[model samples]
Target chain A: MHTTLAWIDYLIMVIYFAFVLGIGFALKRFMKTSTDFFLSGRSIPAWVAGLAFISANLGAQEVIGMAASGAKYGISTAHFYWLGAIPAMVFVGLFMMPFYYGSRARSVPEYLRLRFDEKTRGLNAISFAAMTIFSSGASMYAMAKLIGVLHIFDPVVHALGLPTGYVFHLSILVSAVITLGYVYLGGLTSAIYNEVLQFFLIVAGFFPLVWLGLKNVGGWEGLIAKCPPGFGHAWKGMTNADTNPLGVEWFALAMGLGFVLSFGYWCTDFLVVQRAMAADSMTSARRTPLIAALPKMAFPFLVILPGLIAVALPTPTAVEAPTSASASVVEADALGHGLIPAKVKTDGSIERDSAGQPVLDYDLAIPKLLLHYFPAGLLGLGLTALLASFMSGMAGNITAFNTVWTFDIYQAYIKPEASDKHYLRMGHFATLFGTAISIAAAYVVASYNNIMELLQLVFAFVNAPLLGTFLLGMFWKRATANGAFFGLLSGIGAAAVHHGVSLPAGSVPGVKGAWINRGAEFVANLAGWSPRLPFHAYRNEMAQNFWTAIWAFGVCFVVTIVVSLATKPRPDEELKGLVYSLTKHDVEHGLPWYRKPEVLGVAVVLMSIALNVIFR
Target chain B: MNLDIRVPIGLLFLSLGGLLTGYGVVTHFTSPEIYAQSLDVNVNFWWGLAMLAFGAGMLHYGRRAVARSTAAVGAE
Candidate 1:
């Protein structure tokens, strides 16, 4: 599919880039100290913080992945928003924000150091820093790859007579430079402000696409009529893994994604929590994530509905293949499901099948809809919004990386007694270093199959068991520092081992497959052990991820509890403001009914329940 | 005192809204072909107006907040 952007579209995108850079330069005066640079001086208002909180998490993977899932899996993809996000967001706002904000920890890893011990803090800090860099790299890779696939810049390149070969590398370099410039100027505050702007732009960009698509498809009723059975329901075939598009049981969805992954990300991931922690007051900090939940719940309509509507539209005859070294044509099967992969020609268009039908690429659902539905000026706005989302995600990662690197790694380990100005300078250097590393990481991410699935797998390996350690440390005073650290290590090890042993048939590359096969044979021959472990066979990679997280969480929880019981624990006095039981309960009775976190949390939960019931 | 974000955000939106609205009006009578893809809805015009109104409200609130804080400081 060729991009449909005109000169007007290019103009709009230029204006957006100007506004983003303008905001960064405008906010440079505020960054007089490290606190302001990293945390916005902890004085951002709740609404601004709330929008930025959600927007920072909205990256290239989220926008493209959700739409792709909507087209592939139908309405069940809303589970990522409603079930996987809202509840955890509410829990963080109502219950977890006090420790995160009240204790005045510089970062999440700092909180771990306070609550657990040095080793626990060290593990979390190093892993979190690495994850942020990797995540940033992934976002960069996704944006460059997406721009290449959509050929959005083809017109400009052709007009300028530039070579088409360097488009992907150019996209990466341009985006990296833009992000680095702004982040270097205003730091986290710049990232946060840009994220808020991006949130508005994204809403404005996609609302029209959804409206036009729905109108063309004859509304919700038309969508239900055109799509396959069970496509309209969120929980219909969820009870049985084999019957659903997700191909995962309801238990795994609830326990693994809903409980482990959601809480791990929402509560502990510094990328998002840092936004809320920048709120002006305790009440605002507590309310920040709750306010974010409102938009989070509504995002399925903006992002996911376009994909569903794209699928409901009449099937297209021709499609473009992904621009990889091995470009493959994707063809539809007997039931109109496109999964078969064929070779493609060098010109980027799909090679026709034996029946003379051009293969369709479902991942292009949103971009194709933008091309088909939006007008000229609005198309520019939509493309700008897409670019804004990518930049916002990368900026968030870079900002988080700089903060963690400066405070957790440099301040704590490199120079513990550094002055504020010294750390602030270090933050600037870290931003540059982190951006360079992320560019390298983006190059490394060329091999990944699906952006969203890869992210989920990463979360399973890192965040799942980390959630268990945090859960025990916060509520249970008996949890020892040694227990938490070792438990986390074992949990990550469990996820890796599960992935290694359950290696899906023919999924591994040739070299890795040969080595793994040899290792399996040696183990079986030496110990008389079966090559395969006794685990339930999953239908999809997502299901495998869910099971891996579930097992990891169980192992972490059990190991932490057992080791804590066996070891000595920290005294209660030492745990004040760190442990829930030891901390004082500060109630805000003066606030109005709606301003209260519990009130809003309950409402958010009720709304989520209503959504589930409506689509069940 | 810290600068309120609303002022800058409001100004940015107001500028964008003005640009879009002006373009929409210029193109409405002269060139209808520009909006042929969106069913001739003139989306830029209506959305621009909505943004202008929102931006104005934010600017008003931000100014009032600044006034109140300045008055308190003078009283102190």
Candidate 2:
């Protein structure tokens, strides 16, 4: 079924776009220097920065992917938010923010240079720059694909006399232009401001959808009753890999995802950290991620609940089926028991079976909910919220890209003696360059079938080992620069080796597989050996990703410690403010009970534990 | 902090909230057919009211802070 939006929806979207652009233009005067452009002069309030911090990470994949996981794996997916995110966010707020905000570094890699050495910074900067571009492209691709599948702009395209096929290309161009325009005009300030706005819009948009869906499904008790066995509880079937929808054991879930991947993304990734670092004061900076954790903890109800609700709803199936007992058995087997099965055509239409029943596509759960429940005015707001999320994610990447390029790479390597004005100009130009590259990356992602899976693989390759390097660099005063640099390299090498050996059959199709296999063969030949490795298949790609990160973190941690002990350590004076032990302990005794980070941190942790217990 | 982003954001949300609230009120007496999809919840009305309250709070705090900052500048 094709869902078409009303004119009021279009008007609402236009108004949202106008406000976004107006904010960008309005903030342009504030960008008189590089600091203002890149870091908002470190003057944003905790609430605003906190909202933006979470919004930057809430891209198209996050919203759509979370709902999709909810439908497929049930509440087990809440592990991502509870075990995977909350603890890591709290750890960053309470322990790591002091160094990040105190070191006076402009970017995460800049922090590395202060703590470790130039080579470590360069390695991180180059990889981080590349990763952000790819991530931006992935967001663009997901937005375009979602728009096309949902037929969100079909009415506009038809009214404009444009072919329906141009919808994908149009979605990409419009999002790219809008993001580039705002980010170019106002820099990180604009991005943060819009991210806050997007955060509110997302909550406003999805709140009604979840409410309406729950009401239709007869509320929480109804949902539990309708869903299959083991669907309501988070930890019921988590004892063994084969018993659960996630098909992964609790040990791996806790250690691999909860500890490794979560910390890697939350602590080390500059996309989220940049928002926290832009806070007005050290106290605000420390509290930014903590404030974000409040909403982060509660987000599953908004995004994931729809998926569970969709599963409880009756599956749309073909209208007619064979009446014979043998035919009924075959149909039942083909439908995969209780799972929703849709007969999707090449043209994106859902075809009715012989029984004339409409089939359901689980990926369309959220959009279907929106289309079914919202009226003209609210529908427009919902679409605008989606568009806002996509733009915020893209802007987040572009801003980070420009800052790292201008500060870490260009200023540090290309020309060390450039004026402040010259660096500021470079930042502007880098925004354009980053947007263009992201547009290209979006096209590359379009060629892939699953954007989220591809992104997870990319995260595994880059973030896991990087987190290891940061973990040791921050807490361990004895970690030498040489150890950090080499450990990072070996850690990444371990990740690649693990992936190459354990690659599932038919995971990479056609040209990509050929290229990867050729590279592997060349490496094997160089080492005077054949390219035969043991095949360790995983239950799913997510399991593989968790193991990849686990192995990478292990390698980096062991190697960094071994190498650090072998090499001379930096002086205590030189390590001041950069190392935890060397830094002074200045307690904020004047602050009230609620304002303190420790109090807030404990409260957030307690809330997360409460959620885990309830859900589990 | 210098610009007080709350003012502009507050203005935008307030306008949108007013528009949605007005629509909701107009349709409330007539019982519009479109709201049938939302299980007759009138989500627009309730959410609009919520947004209105939030926007008014933001504007209140934002304007007061702006005035305070201006007064401090005059004293200096």
Candidate 3:
């Protein structure tokens, strides 16, 4: 039977969206000033902020992408969620939040200003805003594509009699319109409430699916009976670069870059920090990110379990013959072994595709599993959860984008003295504008090979530098303003050049004519670039995340300190403010770094090591 | 604000969430057969209904707590 969604499902979704809109209208009374719109009048409790933070980050890319990764890479891919993120989040909660909240800075970029100067803050803010817009667009497009696959909006598409692919675009536009409406009305408050709802729905959706998937695989023993080689294990012991599933050296590179990537996204990404900064009090703000941290630790099971279970089922009859090397591996296992691996004999062999390109289709694994398993009414809730994730993320990004533009860019630059009413209006307008830009960008980026890989590449270019700027601001006292500005720019510029020129897949050095060209191609959608390099290549996109982050922070810290020392400290008043001393001093008589940093540091190191071992 | 009640209760919820998750995972890995049959429609529906109820309850509880805290602060 066709997976037809009944009317009740639609009603449930409508009610859900209506509730979100209700929250927006409810919060409207509080939006007397721009501060309320942007920061929720700083009245959010730790628990709410915490839930919202997790929900915001656990968006479309995460739900679909994490599931996909599990299908492709096996359970070891859980490293991306659990090992890579938990430490960074804990670090942010324990150490970074105090400084960020204490600084009384509006945006993450604003903290850069207090720690350094305006120029640094302005540059970092612009970069972060750009990154958020691009990432948000990519997420929105992916979500639409997923919903279209589920045939959720077929009635609308059929009425219009549009092309098959047209439904995807339409779904995205519909989502954009609804998300933009809520964000524009309630700002951060609306986004937070929506996210909390979305998080619960997501959990409810996935937990049941995991249950169904495991049951299909004949319980744990049956699943273990079907376990392909490299199934439970982190690293398959092959050393050859071509033969290695995830690559021999990539373990280090992935773990290192993963740390850098997580720290940047969780610690510094605007959509995340914007929630933290909106907490009602300092203690709440400090606790919020940490509260979110616990949920994040449990995310792997939700995202990865579906993919692992997919391996146990008989292959679909309509599926095309194995084309990719990885497909061959799956095929081999299915034929000879009873749902077991061909390459390795044991239960836990490093799960990799046959040709060594990490499994790209794993992102599709979770959704495909849902299609295979969940029937009818329950399926509607599952689909709703997925949609909820996408909307929550888009809402979070749009809300943050609006705040940054209105406060940091528009007000700081164009309309400084605008009243609260004018600012709120501008905030709504900014949300609309941001959504429009993101939609356009999403249309361009979605066609490239793997959504998960593309996300990593984007993070490398955009977030690496932000991480650098934030790191220097937090730890290094000597960092100078000019140093930070120059360092930040140089780091991004360098990463682009590294990605663009040096690191395309299979490129030959010095033999330039008709050489292999594989790297991220943002400009391809434009008139100039598509024919020559129509899509961005993964370059076996090794851990540029780790190095770029170092360069960004290293350069900025050195530059900021050298420049500040050489020029002069920004008159003692600005330098000696409570913000500057916040990280260094514990006015509230809390535990200081010399005493408590050990536990946090040890935990971070242990997490990094565990991730490394898994990758290995 | 007096955080002793809030802090412990919050921690309890967090811990329980973690414990349930861990138990769910172990059950998933150890016994897949239990989950595969058409999801127990009764169980699934009831669980959803229960969560919906719980979520609504939490919303009410949170509102009351918030209101009471605000009043207490005002009185002081």
Candidate 4:
């Protein structure tokens, strides 16, 4: 399990750590008020906010998960970037930023309060705060497990005379301390600044790996030749869910991912929106997501290309993996696609499917490729880049949690009016506790992985409903508070019921779904149902996923409209800046043609469409 | 607030690039076989050079920005 690391690699990691901490110390003097600590005094540049916006999402799971998707689904995985995030990012910048920035609300949940009611804000604040800490913990657990698996710290373990098992504990402790140190010292400003630096470092590290890999795989032509049909294409075979690589047809893909999931996340998730909220002016805030969209669209080449390359290359029976995290012994050729290792169980044996074929640990695609190609010095840089992403993501989650807890939960509910200095102190205190709980949650994840998965699934179900609530609250002044509150609850309930009857093709009728099999169908039959049941087993989990989103959003959209017409509407005068139609839409008037978000929005969409065509 | 972000990023990468290039030079003379694993391309040297160029650009741009802001403040 030992991965080779030269002195140069250790030095590289140390220097990176020093730079992060130094940035924190340098920004410490500016934290005299809670506004500075939590919001960066709204003085950040658009580009910096933009980079942080993307970097906040560049967690270990995201990088690994995207690559895994690339390995499993081929170039179609880019659809997640091109179709899923880019449009939502543009919409948030051009359309949503006016309400978010103009309203003097400090947090997303705070905005909910101004637009809707305190009850709605409280519901969102509590759930968001809880999700961030646990998600951060889950990511922390993943990072520590990765460090332990890679055995990069074997020499340090030997030098310190610690047991091999303690490496995991040490990794967790070190990450927590480093993350807490910078965040506590300088708060949101430090996190945002470090994220921008990490953005460059990530590019520096991965760009080379991809270059070497493309060369190894004999360039684009060779990759196309080596891959299976449609592996290199984004739009091929997308008409039918059964044939589509993503197992969801075009309309569901467009509506479910492109609209519901994308807007739900990019527009409402405070983790990224907070970065934009830190911008110096309304114009910068409007530009933040747009600027982020440019790099974001190009990231598939950086992150997803490695997986495509890994599959195209052949596996050496026994790869002398330089940074071997998995067993060096390769399985039968019938088992694996390429250099990607077979999924191993807790007992350290390869996991095989019901078909007797080995299921690849697609998550290890990036790790194996890094080990297969990188030498010592450059290897260090790559691993450091990976570690930087994990830390950055952790810090992103904590920063968001603290703000929500401080402003939405604490300031709103606990102590209605605290002094500026007292609130600043509370911000630091929140960071400390948020991180501590994350550490504890990391241990909980290590023990009860299933519960964590279920929790994440529940969290996913809760997310798509948010965009429905936000869309109504922001665009429609006639949308009532009661409508929003009840509509959100109905959307979540619909997602649950949708999951109740549906199941992915192969999976059993359990937590994966179809738990309500016999009774609902029997009842429907007794009632002499006119048409076929739409909520039956889907082609795959992805098919079920897209439908679930559509169901939730569809339900919330109708319910909110129905309820709004029945209930009393808030006065239009009180909703000036918070409602889109009421806000000043021509604020971009003086900006040059190139600077306007609408122009950039069009250009970004066109570029992404070109990418879809090129890959297709 | 005064600390421009590009300065730290520039300085960090500058040192990192310098380290890699220096090490690459020493290894090219001392242990030539180390480059074999990385497809014999001296990634440390070439990529280090690329990073060095980028780092210096960031540093120069950041310094000019800081200077301009300071000059504006002084004028006021």
Candidate 5:
């Protein structure tokens, strides 16, 4: 069914868009230098930066993807925030923030150059730049696709005689222009300030959705009563892989997601780190992630509750799948699942699960519930929240891309001797360039979706290895440039090789791995004589992803240590601010106990653990 | 640093809340049927009012901050 919007909805959207542009327009005059444009002149408050840090990552993927996972896996998805992000954010705040803030590196890759060698920095900067653009574009594609599917603007567009197909193109164009307009005019300050606004707007929008939804579904306990056993529990069935919907046991979950992947994304990725780096002072910088953790740990409730409510509501009359599910509407209704429509293919045929029942389009969980529960006025706010998420996500990438390009790539290599003014001009040029390419990439994603998957897998291989390099480089002063460079390469190689050999169960070769030997049987044959060498396929793609990261981290960690021992160390004086042992931790003696990173870190961790226990 | 970001955020929310609350009030008086999808509750009225209060709070804090900064500058 086409979900049409009333004039009130249109008015809400117009107000939101106006505020976004006006903020950018307001900030344009203060963007006097590259530092202001790129780093917010190191003047943003801790709370603001903290909010931006989380908001920058809150793309369509995080909101929609988490909701989707919540529908399919139940409360198990909370592990992503509670077990995954909380510890990592706290770690970054209490441990890694000192080096990042103290080093005065303009970007994450620049920090690599200061700690590691040039080649390592180059490899990181290029891959990271490409990854950010692609992901930004992919999110753009998803948002546009969702807008088309919702058909919320169909009334106005159709009245204008606009064809249905152009909805995707119109959505993409509108988002791209607004994103470019803000980032181009005011730079990172604009992006960060707007990210803060987006954060609040998203809460303003989705919070009520969750509230209204829970009331309808009889609150948390009532919803849990309708679900299967362990559906509301976070740690249940986590002892083994097959018992849990996540398809990975507790050990793998802790080591892979909690330790390696979380640290990799939060600590190393420039998108979130940039926010911390923009803070006004070292203390604020360190506190960025710590403050962010407060909202982050509770985010699952806002993003995931709609799905739980959707699944728990007594099954409504089944809305038949787009075209071919007409024959099985009764069958779908009999399954006692409702609201979530079936996933359909390009040919409009219903996609089926292994049991031959229609597979729900879980990504539509949030959208469907919003339409079901919200009236015209609130519907506008909810849709605006979604649109804000997509734009902020894209803007985050654009800002990061321009900074890395201008600082790491242009000044470092292209023209080593240029006035600061020239470089500032280059940053503007880079913003235009990055946004243009991202728009092009969005079109590419619309055509061949596999490129996004392939890019994501590439990102997994790339990002997973870097945390090992950073850990060794910062903690082990002996980690030489050669060691870091080769160790990183070897880590990436090990990740690729492991993925190339072991496939996820029931999946064919290609994006899901096992492209090399097609099975673990072949790899196991090399050490087949020993029972311990019996390697089998992973339970799912996530299981494979976690293991791949583990292999990469392990190899990179060991190789970096060995190579560092063999190679000459960078002198202690050279490593002063960058290395943990060499650097002096700034004493915040004047601050009260509650203001300390240690205090905040402990508080955040305990709160997250409390959540796990409560949910468990 | 450029400008207090909270000021703009406050203004945006204030206007948004006003529009929503106005619409909600109109519908509350003229036609309550608009809230049927929302389980017979006037979400627009309630949530809009909540937003307006939040916006007002933010603006109050933001203005105080600006005033305090200016006063400190004058004292210096």
Candidate 6:
């Protein structure tokens, strides 16, 4: 398809990229020490950290992924934003953040060490870093693909004479490089500052698409006219097979995964956890995440609903659905039929219908809507929001990567006696290394069926094990080092086994029929040769994914707690130290009346009960 | 987070239902040709109102929370 962006639009994107780089360069002075680079020297105000944390979480992939799901899954897909994210944020704000901030740790891994043992902390840090690389890399590739589709960097691809197949990798490489350059130069301060700017734009950009799409689809009426029966219903025709909004298994999985994943992400993920750790006071840090929760409650409309509107509007004839990676958006009607639809592959090839006509790529829903519907200046602003979302997220992850590697791994293990200045330099070096690894990993990503599925798979294994170990240590005093280590390994092992075994036999619960099966006989026939196998693989992989891992977390947590009970407790001092991490009090210093363990414990329980109702 | 300026979030809700009602009235009087083309306008009026209501609800809750917190602080 021909490019939709005019030369001016291209120039605007270039200027945006340059501005981000300039911001990185400008903030270098603030990043003098390891503390400064890692956590913005722990001076970030609550609001900035709040916005940056939210911005960082809503990366390009999430915006597009949620939109794509909205197009394909309709209102049912909103559960991910509402059920999965919002509640999780509330949990983090009220419960998880207190634990994170009170611990007074540099990173989540450090918290793990205080809560569990040295071995678990080190292992979790490494696992988390690796997981971040996969997630951040996928996000980079997705963002790059979107930019390429929008023609922001199409000329560079043409000039390089690279195959269209390489565009995904090229996109990942460019995004990662830019992200790394800024993060390496400045670190968390630049990331947070830039995020605050990006958040407003991202919200503003969404309005035009939604307004226009609503207008074009004949307003809300036109959308309703175009939609199939029960399409607009938030439940999307899901019933007893799913007792709740999601099926029983899915609900269990959603809640279970929601519990484990949210706790892990809010409590342990360095990218977010470090934000709270950077606060000026324990209360500010504890409250920042909750303050951020307000935004989480409403973000899905700005990001996801536009794609749903895209489904109501006419599909663009110009673009074709690329592979699963390329097709982040889909038609709401086609998706309701339970068919994934023929999308553009990474190779930029299209499949044909029964009459041999080319299929429309559903992923172009948002872009096509933007091109045809949006006016000139608004278009540029919208694109900026998109770009900002990508950059802020990638930048934050990259900074977190550098901080964890430099402090937790390099300074702690590789060069224990390194000076602060030397370690700060090492932090910069690690940012470069992380970028390189992510770019390399992006190449293998194309072979994977679905980018989001792939991310959840890795995150499940990485997060579940760590979440189990930490939960045990925090709540159960009897949890010993041996139990923590073994429990962590066992949780990961269970998830890995479930992920592996569920595939190949057609048993994965949420895996839909392949895209090839969605088209007319002609495409369906082709789906036989290349087969629906690829798309099926993606479906199966995502089926029972995070939920499965949540179950694993629960099982491992129980086993560890039980096993620890049978074993002897550690010395009083050791136990007291573990307890102190949760209370943010010194061991030798007696607690004040308000700081009494019983008071805090009751507050925690009451908060959890309130959250349970709010989430439900 | 405390705010003295107050805007009734209920206005957002009134606009939602009000917009759709106005559109429905306008469409009723339009020519047949225009009416067919204007169906989308009608839908937008309705859904937009829904959105307006939701947004208004959020504003109301936010305002209430702020008020309560402020009251607590004042009492203290």
Each prediction's RMSD to truth: 4.0, 4.9, 8.4, 3.8, 4.0, 10.4
* Candidate 4, residue A376: lDDT: 75
Scanning candidate 1 chain B in windows of ten residues, the lowest lDDT window is B1-10
Sort the predicted structures by lDDT, highest score first: 5, 4, 2, 1, 3, 6
The superposed Cα distance between candidate 4 and the true structure at residue B56, in angstroms, equals 0.8
Residue-by-residue lDDT tens digits, candidate 5, A379-405:
999999999999988999999999999
lDDT of 1 by residue, A495-525 (tens): 8766655533334422112334556666787
Q: What is the lDDT of residue A15 in candidate 1?
A: 76
Regions of candidate 4 where Cα sits further than 4 Å from its true position: A319-335, A446-459, A515-535
Residue lDDT tens for model 3, A290-342: 77766776687778767677776766432532343244434434442222223
Candidate 6 structure, TM-score to reference: 0.74
Give the best candidate by DockQ. Answer: 5
TM-score computed on alpha carbons, candidate 5: 0.93
lDDT of 4 by residue, A1-616 (tens): 1366899999999999999999999999999999999999999999999999999988865677677777777888888789989999999998898888888688999999999999989988998998888878887887787676566787798789998888888988998899999999999999999899989999998999889988987898887778767778888888888776778889988888788877888899999999999999989999999999999999999988888887887865555433344453344322567767665565767777677777676766777788777877788889888888888989999999999999999999999787988889899999999999999989877432222223335445777888899998989889999899888889988998888889877666667887677456667889997434444878866667778888998898899889999998888889988888777676566889999878899999999999988988
DockQ pick, better of 1 and 5: 5
- Worst lDDT run of 10 residues, candidate 5 chain A, spans A447-456
lDDT score of residue A515 within candidate 6: 23
Measured with C-alpha atoms, the lDDT of residue A140 in candidate 4 is 83
- In every candidate, what fraction of the native interface contacts is reproduced? 0.41, 0.56, 0.13, 0.85, 0.82, 0.00
Model 1 ranges with Cα > 4 A deviation: A1-4, A158-161, A318-361, A503-536, B26-31, B70-75
What would the C-alpha RMSD of candidate 6 be, to one decimal place? 10.4
Give lDDT tens digits, candidate 1, residues B1-76: 3455666667766866676677678779878776776766887777778768877887788788888888898999
Clashes of each: 0, 12, 23, 0, 0, 19
lDDT of 2 by residue, A478-499 (tens): 9999999999999898888777
On the 0 to 100 scale, the lDDT of residue A111 in model 6 is 73
For residues B2-53, write the lDDT of model 6, one tens digit per residue: 3211222233234433543454455446522322332334433444456456
> Candidate 2: which stretches are off by over 4 Å?
A317-362, A447-450, A503-534, B26-31
